[model samples]
Target: MTNKLKLYFKAAQSAKIGIWEINLETNLIYWDSVTRCIHEVSEEFIPTTKNTIDFYSIDKNRDEIELLIERAIVEGTPFNKTFQITTAKNNIKYVEGICQIEFLNKKPIRLLGTFQDITKEQNLINELQQSVEKFSSIFSSANDAIFIIDISNGIITNCNPRASELTEYDNSELVGIHNSELFPVKYRKEVRVFLKSHLTKDNYIVNETYIKTKSGLTIPVEVASGKKFKVGDQTFSVCFFRDISERRNVEENMNMLSLAASETTDTIVIANPKGKAVWANNAYLKLTGFNLQEILGEKAGYLSKGPETDKRTTDKIRKAIQDKQSIKVTILNYNKQKEKYWFELNITPIFDNNNNCINFVGVGRDVTARKEKEFELRGLLEVTSHQNNKLFNFAHIVSHNIRSHASNLSMVVDVIENTENTAEKLSYFELFKEGTEKLSETIEYLNEIITIQKNTNIEKKEIRLKDEIEKTKYALSLSIKESQISIIDTIPEDLTVCVIPAYLDSILLNLFTNAIKYRHPERKAILKIGYEIDESYTIITFKDNGLGIDLEKNGHKIFGMYKTFHGNDDARGIGLFITKNQLEAMDGKIEVESKVGMGSIFKIYLNEK
Candidate 1:
């Protein structure tokens, strides 16, 4: 071979192109050094036509190359094709085969071709195709609006489906349109300037702007833009935008609700169904004298109930909340200063769409003054009812006692008129006189009762209960001596009770007289008097070992007028009644305990004036 020809052949081999030939007559193949290297065979190895064909892929590759060679030989035509082959070492590669047939006398004998390794080029093409497919997938499925723009002209090259959706435009209409078409008129100039500055830096840039939809409605949006890449002389950028109208609206509504809650005057609390407070408004803090930090996650009732709070009302509130029902109650509560107050509380159960109790809303108003007024009104009503009953009893006494006395006097006077004997007439006149005297006594008793019912200003004075007992014992000394009663005064000398002087004297005198009058016939009468102070009240007690009355049968009537028990000869049932009236008139109370045979105790509670 010539040197230049050898140099040319060496250059082709350096380029990784291998020359191959087949001799039809010998049915053999010839391969250059490059060909043997390409096949990964031994350097000195000679190959047969069949083995050389096996170097191609098993089925389609081998058959196609063989048919191409046959056509080049038989038709005397040249052909070039790219096909795959598996080398002797099991490495698969793509190679281009260009074949030509050499003929003598127009009869085909030899085929020649060159095999070039095109594996790297084919791999790069495959990688580019995969990258395109990945880009296509992401562009179509992104949630945010995406745009590909030519930075030089501000023209849109492509837009994703989401971009079209946000702009209310079709995908076909969006492509090839200027980016300014999507921007509001006022923002178009700013957007252009922003794009220009950002393209130079090629760094990510985020800006907020308003966009005009296809229907011309302006919507706020956030744009995240950056230069994605450069292709040849063209610089491309990508922008992602999302509409922020809904998020802004939510923030605005939340601000308004927070403002209202902070400024409302009613005490409000939001709590879980377990009664733990989740939120408390400013009014709640003022009402309860506690801050939100102190009460949060604590039981709502912790601040609402104190020593004087009604337990029954608290239990009802809890049950109502647990059952997801609304309840309204007025209960006494205390503040940080430990002052008593009343509140009208309204608790409403808050439920979700699933009908599950999620929380409770409690609203409270201060009703302390109103409650106090109601208490006073109730006391007045009770006093009026008591007075009415007393008046009715007075009428009954007038109709029964006074009429009987008057009828007796008229009958006696008629007898006096019909009698002829002076003794009988004088006896009738005496009967008339006795009936008038009894009538006068009844009238005087009625007058005393009427006086007791009137709201007179009785002056109160600090008087020793023991001194009062001594005075009463002196006044009833004759009765006491006649009954041979024993008096025992256990009252403390220093203990003083506030009472009207006359009422106190009358009360003690009546008690001593009753004890002597009702003395047991079997035992000597003994009276024990005692006094003590309990909180704001001074208690005076009179206990006597006497003919005890049965309280079970006559307890309600013990203090009633004209009501008698034990059928005692001197039992007018008026002294005890009058005694009760005087004590109550001085804003004091009287109670009694007695048994048929065991004796009786009368207890009086007087205020400390």
Candidate 2:
């Protein structure tokens, strides 16, 4: 190659582009050294017109490039095209060429063009275009309201269809409006402060606030705002907003329902199917002495009967809950202090949407007084029946014993009148006298029982518990010392009892004497007396470690008159019967827990003054 041609090739290589030209008349082609290099061809190779045309990519592109070249040559037109070309190594390369028709004497004869390798630039442009198209599609089709605002002027430059619908404005009306205008007047300052803080810190802001519609009504909106930049060196703020009015309304309704539930009078408790408490009203807390935090997720059976309650009643309650049915029953429940009281539970099963049992809703009311009244009436009837039976038996005994004595006396008188034997008459008179004494003793015992029955109407007054215990101890000081019995009076001095003073004394005396009389043979007698004051009742317990009765065998007859446990000559069994009557007269109660060879505890619950 000549030096000029070599310099020209070096210049084209330095430019990183190829140079090519076509001769229209002979259909010949010329390629520069850089062009040969781009096609992976030798510098000495002769490029034929057909071979060069074949270098263009096959199919429509090759045909199109040929037509463009022919048109430029024949009509003196310029042509520019970007098309793929196949090199000598069969590798595809992208090239952009600009061609100008060269004219000689007003007739197109030659074509001059410069071709450049732009594969990298074209690929980058294609990828960027795809990304822009994807983002544009997402921005227009998103369900949530979207807005692009000019940060400097606070003007909304663009908005989605959802944004227009949410603000109750058309696209034209919202495009140039200030973002603060979309918010209520009260929230404008807050919005400004938020924007300022977000811009200063370059942080994203997400919050719930009220927005004003075109009709001036406020609607709840959740907004997410952040900064964005466009290709034109324009900075904008992007906001995503969603309506939350329905969610807020639902929360308000739930709060209202909770408030109403709290104000109810009946004790209401809701438990899941697993028997864990889920919700408990205020009345329930007050009735059960449990707070919401203490009872939530706790088993409902925690409120069941304690040691003093009847097992049968508790069993019935469990069965009712298991059956998922409404139950109205009275049960004895212990309060926080372990004091027993009666309550009427009305339990109903609550079902879920599937019509399956989901929970139990129980409403309860304290019925201690009503239960006490019922027990009192039953006791009265039992007492009347016992009295009637005793009277019938007494009549029969009275007739037999009195008539036998009287007949003997009458016979003695007859014999004294008929016979003159002084010694025999005196002996007969002595026998008659003995019989009359026996009858008088029988009549006295009957009168004592009648007196006890008549004293049921004795008036009651407030009496200090400690004073009564002291006085009773003083009265039995000798017996207590002789028996070596230890009396532990744990009862508080402040505790008082509402009872008939005389009856209180009589009841305590009987209990004390019995404890001493029934002292166990194996050990020294230990007596414990204590009292507890509850909301509506005062309970006094008298416990003794003495000869405890066999409650399993003799529990029912322990309080019956003439029933005796020990074979002692003084075991008349009338003391407890009379003591129970006295306590009953004052609307009080007595309960006993005992085990053979173990011990005995007597609990007396009375009304609080």
Candidate 3:
């Protein structure tokens, strides 16, 4: 190869340009090194006239190229066009093809073409076109009226469809109009000077103004914001205008109260300095279900006070009136028909020129629904708290009480199995049966307690307190014997307490077990059970000579879950917590008094106050 030819090929390769030829008579196709690389074909792959055209995409590009080749061969025509092709690697590319015919004796024999990869340039052009189309769509379809104004002269150079609709002007008329021409005559001068201030910087602060339509109707508008745009040396401002006519009407209505008297919905009353009713608004009359004649001369709140009204609240209002000062209170009141409602009242004092109190005004509204919902929410929270405590209590009962019963049954069964005599074995079998029955009863009672927790309500029965105590004593007879604890019951036989039977049983059992579990090692443990009747409660006391808890240190946490004092190995610390929750579930509570060495006196108050 010649040096000049090598230089020419190198230049072509640098520009990604390649050369190709098609010979018509010989049915041969030739591709240079750069051309073959552009087609992504292997070096050893031979090119034939039939297979060469297949490199062009199997779409319009392939058909168009075939047509161009035939024209060049028949009429010696030349063509320059861009074609899309799929390379041997199946990657799509765009190529620019410039071809002309090579003639032999005035007839076409071969066609020569330059193929250059133009994919990157074509992709860039496509992206730029898409960006332009996107911005054009946003400008035309914007919700707010858009204006492009000459910042120097304040002339509206361009506008959107929305701008024409807002100003009631055609697109051509709106384009060349000055910005001030769109505003009312009174505001035009101000609007003109305001627009002219955008000489160096765009002012984007929203300014409120009125726009004059074609028919001279003034509509409210806000020049929402603006951005600076530049084309060559000239600068323009892109402004957005929003119609605020509805908003203006709303603001005006809020500013002015119609007649300012009957417009308000809250009850209003004017009373004399002595707090006697003098005048009342229609809302007050409607709320109380009384006419003006019936309400006049009556004390301001006399009509609403009922049998259930709180005297403390009434006294508070009376003191406020006597002092001639303003007061706000939410008081329970009744309508004329005796229906209950919660009144949120605000009282104000009016004084004369001499500063002596002359009149009083009371503004109130029925907040019964809101107050009731608040009360209901409080009750729900309490119920949730109770259910949560019961969940803990249920787990303790399952682990401790059920295990105790199971242990008794296992011991009784082993005794029955090991006994040699038939009668003794029979007696042990009966004891075993009793233990099994007790275990089953414990499970049923636990299930009942859980069901009551879910229901949030429990039914009480009149049961003899002495009988419940005796039953608990019998259940814990073995523990009492092992601990050498003496039991003394002072509750009378006929004294009955209104309580849930299962809860009473559980409460008594927990007290009995606690006395045995925490018995003093030095002194003889004695559990003295006593009760007293009061006007509001049936107080029951369970005093035990046991390892008493330190009230100063552990008083607050004695009834808390998982809290143990005195550090006994078997002190699970769950009995007292469960006992407290069970009592609370039944509208009762437990209190304790104790010293470090002395015994603990647990007083169970078992009635509602």
Candidate 4:
């Protein structure tokens, strides 16, 4: 071989691209350097027709390449192909081969071809194609409806199976149709305006709109639209739509049910899980004297009087909402007018699809009239019991007073009849006269109780609470000092209570004496007087750090006649009962809370005038 040919061969071997030539007349072939290397042949190996054919891939590839080569040589055709080739090393490689027939005067002379390895490039292209196919499949198979629309005409160009099913139309029927056709006539114009705004603004938006189906039924639909670029010069809009008809129907049904419940005398309110009112029915508005718009978004406790309402009832409501359960409670509620009323509230927690608490629904009914009847019955029973107790006590007093006087008279008369001395008779008669006077005083005391029952109304006037406390303290200075008591006046100077002067003085005097008499021996007594003014009433709290009474055991009889907690000889037991009656006569009330060792607090609620 010449030096130039040897250099060409060396260069071709380094290039790794196969080079070949074929004689058109004899159908003989030749392979240079890399071609021989591809066949795994030694430099000295002879190039032959059979060996070259063995390098072509087996089966169809080999036959296909052979036919192309024959056509290039016989018909002066040019051929280019990429095919798999198996080498002697048992390795497969992808190769691209191109051949052109050299022609002179329309007759073929020889064929020239080149082969290059394209395995890596072809494999990369195949992988990328597979990834695209996978993504396309997922997009088309998703449950949510998807659509591609023409922005200019609002025509639906493409849609997935879900979209077709949702609209009740096949792809052939829906394609090329105006998007406005899917909306009801009333909403079609609105939909057009929305689309125009979205397209003009080039902004993505999520919205809910009504869609009319092929069956002529309107349904709620949620749509998300964005701009997507196509290969064309103009941009196309892509919109994703989902049928939310079922969800909307459920919500409407719930609202209807709530309205139905509210129409009855029962009040109904729906609140979010945080206990904020979301919806208040008409009945609830009427019962609370608050409009739905005013109460919505406010806390559920906004209608409650914090001091009068039972804290445990509020706590139970919170717990039920947190635990996603139902709770029923009877609680005191105040209306917009600040009038106190009682209600039986049934609260139920509403849950979402995931079993999480989403909201709370409360159904309530006013039990104020029923509670008032109960209170009246209780008052009647108390009055009857008091009357029975008064009668029994009166019997003892009558026997003690009347019998003593009568017996004295009888003894004096007998002494006068049997005695000879006038002076002894006159002394006995004076004693009998004194006994008659005592009897008259006892009869007057009984008449006082009857007068209280018949006429309880008393004129009221505004009296300063602090001044009343100070006056009572001054009046009982000696008793207060003897008890070693400390008085803390937390009541505001301007705080005033409405009561008659005489009744107020009597009430204060009775409470002061009781406090001093029951002062705990182990510690100095501390009395706290405070007052709070509410919208409709003034509450005065008189708390004493003294020996407290057992409320549970003695609360029923605490304000009854002849009921006494302390065993003091001076405790007439009628003081508290009379004080309570006096306060009641002026349309006021008293409530007490106490612990055996902690202390006792008495709250007086009087109407604000």
Best candidate, TM-score: 3
When summed lDDT is taken over every stretch of 10 residues in candidate 4, the lowest stretch is 450-459
Model 1 residue 205 CA deviation (Å) reads 1.0
Q: Which pairs of residues have clashing backbones in candidate 1?
A: none
Tell me the lDDT of candidate 1: 0.79
Best by lDDT: 3
Q: Write the per-residue lDDT of candidate 2 for residues 54-74, one digit (tens) a residue.
A: 888778889988898778866
Q: Tell me the deviation in Å of residue 235 in model 1.
A: 2.3
Tell me the lDDT of candidate 4. 0.76
**Residue 204 deviation, candidate 2, in Å?**
1.5
Ranking by TM-score: 3, 1, 2, 4
RMSD of each: 18.4, 19.4, 22.0, 16.2
All candidates' lDDT scores? 0.79, 0.77, 0.83, 0.76
Q: Is candidate 1 or candidate 3 better by lDDT?
A: 3
lDDT of 3: 0.83
- Shift of residue 96 alpha carbon in model 1, Å: 3.0
Superposed Cα RMSD, model 2? 19.4
List candidate 3 stretches off by more than 4 Å: 1-259, 352-354, 410-431, 450-454
Report, for all candidates in order, the number of backbone clashes. Answer: 0, 0, 0, 0
What is candidate 1's CA lDDT for residue 558? 92
lDDT for each residue of candidate 1 in 169-239, tens digit (9 for 90 to 100):
99899989999989888899998888777877878999888899999999999998875688999878999
